[model samples]
Target: MKKLIINADDFGYSRGVNYGIIDSHQQGVLTSTTFMTNMPGAEHAVELANQNPDLGVGVHLVLTCDRPLLDTHKTIVDANGDFRKLGFYKGAFTIDYEEVYDEWKAQIEKFLSFGLEPTHLDSHHHINSFGDIPEVFLKLAKEYNLPVRNNMDITEDIKTTDSFSYLIETALKDDQSLNELFESNQTVEVMSHPAYLDKKLMDTSSFTYPRIDEVEFLTHPRIIELIDARSDIQLSTFKDI
Candidate 1:
């Protein structure tokens, strides 16, 4: 059987994002999502998750995007104390692995404090896959006994999807069919960012307006019909794996 996990990233990014993810899951084929525990709408996201127990929820580990939960540190934060922007990671930058582990551990702990059992682990901007960070990421995964989104560079004995794809952008840009995307993989994780645009999203992320389009694409009737018709294709969540 071909099992597909359509996971929405940044579930707790904002009220707009939280609503968009829920809409996609309830009305569309989205099976799972990861929460940004440090985001402003985290509590709201938790409430929604509590209301919809079937939607698989996990922690979206962070090192970039928002302020850290721990006290300000030299390596991960800028002079203003917020996490350095994405560009900082792209260039020559220094990150302390110990700090990353501590912050991420706290993020997961915060998520657990809400009484929600997390289904898995992933990172914001794929930061956990960068440099020596996978060491820390895998350490936490083993400690927590949680599955992770596959990062090909990491060779540790960690639980993860067989393959991973950013389906929201690739599907729209290449017009690829679902079967082509899934190929021979029995278990695939397709990443998506589906959200309604709001002032917080607009100010915080440059990739804002396209999320509204993703919500539409994810919930499209044709996509739902295609999955339903394919007996070989089963929609699944991380927890199911």
Candidate 2:
């Protein structure tokens, strides 16, 4: 059997994002999502997660979008103390691994404070996979006993999917069927950012507008039908891994 985990990232980025994620899970094939504990919509997202008991919620450990939960950091923050944007990570940059470890632990603790048992771990902007950061990420995951979204480089004995793909739009653009995308891997994790457009999202995120399209595609009848008709494909959550 091929297990497919369609995980919606940025669950608590904004009210629009939180609502869209819940809609995708309740009405579409999305089985799991990761929550951004530092965002403005964090509490709202947690409430929604409590209401929807079946949606596997996890920590979307943030390093790029918002301010740290703890005090200002030495390497992870900018002059203004907010997190440096994605461009900062793209360039040659230096970061303290210890700082990353502490901030991420705070995020996980905050998630637990809500009485929600996190299903797994991932990161905002895939920063956890960046230079030497996987060491810290894996360390935290081990301590917390949580699975992770496959980083594709780490060979450690961590729990994760066999393969990870951020190719939902690309696959659709190339007219590739979902089953064909899953054929080669026994387990696959498809990363997605599906949200409704809102003032906060447009102001804070560069990857806006397309999220609206993603919600449409994710909740589309055809996509759900395709998954339902395929007996070989099992829609799963990280908890099941």
Candidate 3:
């Protein structure tokens, strides 16, 4: 059997987002989530995650469109202390490698402070896709003894809901390391954002409709809900394995 870890990203972004994530956990196949340390509702996400101890949580490292966990990088924030408007799918790429590393390290600290035993690391807006960031992120992941999501172009298979069938082909086309990681690890977490669109999310600069639909289809929430609600069930975590 193919074991999978489905992780929801942007936890603690907004109340709507937090509610959606928690509800998805109650109502869907959401086994895990990545917390945004710098967002408004981070504490709320933490509370919910703590309540649902079965849900795995990790750090959603924020380097763009949000305040840096470190004191540097005023470029990422405006005068009001609100993060700049570089939403996902449209952030302008920059080569601020030193700043990125500093901020990411601080975020790791922040996640630890929240008592989140992170399963892995992933960047906000896939910022690691920019110049030199991927190498730096991987280096930190290795140092921290955590797994990082490498770009394997799984998004294409994800779009078709044929992830099982096309994973190997897409992984080969995108990154060989990802294929090796998938093969070697008995469990791997795939970072994703799946939620219902509330006003806050809909009005946000980065709202995308396809992602919502993808969440609905890929999660298959109804089945999971029935199984858990109708029968005794125990969620598997890294510790379990």
lDDT of 1 by residue, 66-179 (tens): 899988577999888898787888867777878888899999999999999999999999988777788898899899999999864645577788788876656423324666
Cα RMSD of all models vs. native, in order, equals 1.9, 1.7, 7.8
Candidate 1 pairs with clashing backbones: none
Q: Once model 3 is optimally superposed onto the true structure by TM-score, how far is the C-alpha of residue 88 displaced, in angstroms?
A: 11
Off by over 4 Å in 2: 170-176
Question: Which stretches of candidate 3 lie above 4 Å from their native place?
Answer: 74-94, 152-191, 196-199, 208-241
Report the lDDT of model 2 for residue 175.
23
Q: Candidate 2: RMSD over Cα atoms?
A: 1.7
Over 84-201, each residue of candidate 2 has an lDDT whose tens digit, in order, gives: 8888888788988889999999999999999999999999999988888888998998999899988646555778998888877654332256656766778888888889999999
For model 2 the local lDDT of residue 29 reads 84
**lDDT of each candidate versus the true structure:** 0.87, 0.87, 0.61
The model with the greatest lDDT is: 2
Q: Give the TM-scores of the predictions, in the order they appear.
A: 0.95, 0.95, 0.69
CA lDDT of 116 in candidate 3?
74
TM-score, candidate 3, is: 0.69
Q: Tens-digit lDDT track for model 3 on 1-241?
A: 3344556778888777777777767767667777888877788888888899888777788866546666656545567654555452254555456766777888888878988798767777776666556677776776677755545332221111112222312232222434453564544444456666666666663755745653554446444543345222333333333
Worst 10 residues of 3 by lDDT: 157-166
